[model samples]
Target chain A: MTVLLDVRGLNVTIGGKPVCEQLDLTIEANQSWALLGRNGAGKTTLVHQLAGLRPVEAGRIRINGHDLTELSPKARAREIGVLLQHSSRGFGASVFETVLSGRHPHLSTMAWENAEDHAIAKRAIARLGLDALSERSLDTLSGGELRRVELARLLAQETSLCLLDEPMNHLDLAYQASSLDVLYQTYVAPSRAMLMVLHDPNLAYRACDHWLILLGDGHWRAGPRDSVADPALLSLTYGHPIERIDSTHGPVFMPRTSLEGAPDNHDAAD
Target chain B: MPTAQHKRILVLALFAGLVSLWLATSTGGTAIPATEVLTHLLSNDGSTHDEIVDRLRLPRALSAFAVGGLLALAGAFMQVLLRNPLGDPYILGISGGASAAVLGVMLLGLPAFWHTPGALVGALFSTLLVFGLSRGAGDWRSERLLLTGVVIAAGWSALISFVLSISPPVRLPGMLFWLMGDLGDADRPLLPLLLMSLGLAIGLLRARDLNLAARGLTQAASLGVNTARLRLELYFLGALLTAAAVATAGAVGFIGLIVPHMVRRLGGTDHRILLPAAALLGGALLVLADTAARSVISPMQLPVGVLTALLGVPTFLFLLHRRVRT
Candidate 1:
């Protein structure tokens, strides 16, 4: 199998604090993995380094035999599609223009859009059910709708690897399923790989073939979903006793206590 | 659908521009008929009507149109580059820098070259200074940039006031007239420079990288935009255009801040369309505004800049309200 993304000794820091330390990850083509962590577990920071938004402080990252540090920004953008956690509300771009901006990596300077770019944007928008809102300002969208728009933009990038930070954030129940479904059907089912930061363990188990869980204090474990989904491993990650509950689909987590100083009985109510 | 409205507006502005040009030439201090002015403009004969229409009215009208267009285009570029509605040509102290340089020259009895070259140098210098100070340890901060520009503007305005207060009576009228900003001094030497700046602005309008750069430094860099280089290029282009306009017509204001807002409101905020549309509409709008300045008081003309403020502020406030309501 072709290795799509390879990271060794990766360390990420922001504002003088180490977010992720001594991390190593490898992803192969056609692989789909969920990056599971609690809040502030450095999932976003790790992926940001992979996307080249923030420089990696102490490690080497290679994508398809090309050293990421040596590649120009345009070249890196041509191969990796990133979906940030929350896009700015001030962009004021229309839905179509926002998606079209993803094609910037492929076009030359002073070049006008050709027919192919427009067709790609149209297909991405259609996949997200945003054809009706093609001309509407992005600022007018609800949170879930905005997430789908961002996904469409990633689709427009047409890269081989996706580095998504919390792809399911701000989505409602139905749209949460929809967002994952679309990501699975579009990117994962084919040959491309996806490394997505996920907050919900149930969503992680349901959608991802592989799981990588980051403990609060920088320790992490990664393997196939069945190998990493045990209650003991999850309890070590979230730092509380976790119980499996019966669900129509399968098993799901029920936390015995809140890690953030909430009362123990409140978990049942939640 | 909205494109149809834009086309209608463009046609209306063009028709208004033609009518105002005729009215400006005819209703000057010595009232000539429109037919005679047109005939004089077309003829090579050194007739009395020909001298008035060609030497006096036409240059002033052209200066007003060009300076107005330049300032508006600069403003539109600044607004997009900084991602702030308040970012105009003057927001970064370009006008204050020019004004201070000119005031220093007029007050200190400098050589003849001081007026034009001083203005351009000052405008370019201040743009670089603002760009330098607003940069963070790694990237540019919008709030800091705006604050630094405001500070520079305040300091320069105070210096200009000091110069004006201490100047001798002999140069006071010239200095004060320059400050008031009339289109009365449109000499032949300035026409080529105005055209050059217009060309530069048109070239900048083709920079597609600017669209990506407007979305914050991090966002821009993630999309393969060379954020640092594009920022410097845009600042250079905007400053060059503004300084050239300031050099020609002496501190025209308010057109830059208002015209781009109107364009963004009508044509959408995409720079591919906003840049060109703002330039044309701004030129036509100012031509008509200058006509009103000259014709409303007849023998005693109000300063063209004053008329622009009087017309622009109210419309801007109305647009603000309308935009808020929608």
Candidate 2:
């Protein structure tokens, strides 16, 4: 398999706390990887590092055989698109204008969007079901609608690799499924890959072909889903007892809850 | 590309600006008739109107227009940089720094032209100070930059107060007029006009990146915008524009804060349209305000800054109220 993204000896720290230490990762083409970790496990930091927004303390990141540091942010951005956890919406730009901004990586600073750029943005918007909201101001949208608009913007970016901090945030079940479906269909091509931070184990299990689980204190496990999605490893990573139940559809991982006889009367009343 | 509505608004603003410029030139202290004003302006008939038009009112009007345009453009950039609706040229204390410097010059009994250079120096100093302090060994967040500017502005305000309190009574009126944003003393319009055009051109060229920046730094960076470079350029441009405006018109208020917001409400938020539209509207607004400032009291001209606030406050409130109603 051709490697699309390679990370070697990555050392990242936030507030003097070591988040990622001597970590190495290799993502191959046509692979979708889910990043699972507890809160404060540096998921967003890692995403930022991959996107070239944050500096890696000690590491070499190569995208398609080019050193990430050697490339300018704009050049790196052409190969790797990112969707951050939160974005400011105070500018009051319309959806069309906002999505068109996603084409900045492909165009020069002085060049305005051409017909082709507009077509790409329009197709992305249509694919994400944002055509109805194209002219509406972004501030007027609900949280879910805004998330979809951002996803459309990511799609409009049209990069070879996508780094999504939390793709499922602020989305309903329907949108969650549809967004993942769109991501799967659009990005899981011969030369494309995606790395997403997900909180839901079921969605990760169902959608991702590879997994990278970060256990706190500079330890992590990364491999194919079949090799890394062990229930005990996940339980240790999350500090909870996890149980895998095989349903008719597929395997589902859930937190194991202790079932006692009956609760005390006082506890029950409370 | 601007839509039909945007085009219409632009045409209307241009028309209004032309009319306001004519009115400002014709209705000054010596009320030259419009026909004679135009005739002499077109023909250079050596009439006394020629002297007034060429010497006093024309430079003043152009200076006012350029100053207004610069402030508004700076305000628009600041709003995008800080990602706050309330962002304005004065928010970073550029005006405070200039005011303090100008007040100090006045207190020292310096020549009139010295205040301009002094104000420019002070503005640049304050900007560098805020920029340096906000970038201390960590991430460059807009909130931190804003906070640093606000605090530094407060410091400048205290310094201005100290200078004002010690100034002689003879220089008090001049100091007060400058603080209130007077255009009467604006002798040279060329530098401000040049700076205004340069800012507008640069702003238009980078409008798309600015639009991305308005979404946030991370978003802009992810979209291939060199956010750090963009921020640095904006800061430098915004500071330069503010310095030029302050030097030209003594820290005019309200035009910077309200003009961009007004334009955004009328025309959508595309910076390509928004930047030029704000320039035209801002130039028109100030010319009209200056006209009112000179004519309202006849022999005793009110400071243009006071008139801008008086006119801008009610108009801005009306626009906000209308938006809420809609």
List RMSD in Å for every model shown.
4.1, 3.0
| Superposition error at B254 for model 1 (Å) | 2.4
Per residue, candidate 1 scores C-alpha lDDT tens digits across B295-321 of: 788777777778776766676567446
What C-alpha lDDT do the candidate models reach, one value each?
A: 0.75, 0.84
lDDT of 2 by residue, A1-270 (tens): 889999999998888877778889999999999999999988898888888888768989999999988888788889999988875565678888888888888887677788998999999999989999999988789888888888898898889999888888889999999999999998888899999999978889899999998887788889989899888998998999988888998889988765535556787778
- Candidate 2, residue B227: Cα displacement in angstroms equals 1.6
Model 2 ranges off by over 4 Å: A258-270, B109-113, B128-154, B311-326
Positional deviation of residue B250's Cα in model 1 after best superposition, in angstroms: 3.0
| Candidate 2 structure quality by residue, lDDT tens digits, B1-326 | 45687787778768877887898889877888897777766777667889899888988998988988999998898878777655666767887887788778777778867866887778778878876888788545666776887899899878877888887878778878888899988868898899999999999988888888888878888877788788988887888888888878887876877888888887548888889888988888898888899888988899998877776667656754654563
Best candidate per DockQ, number? Answer: 2
Our tally of clashes for model 1 stands at 0
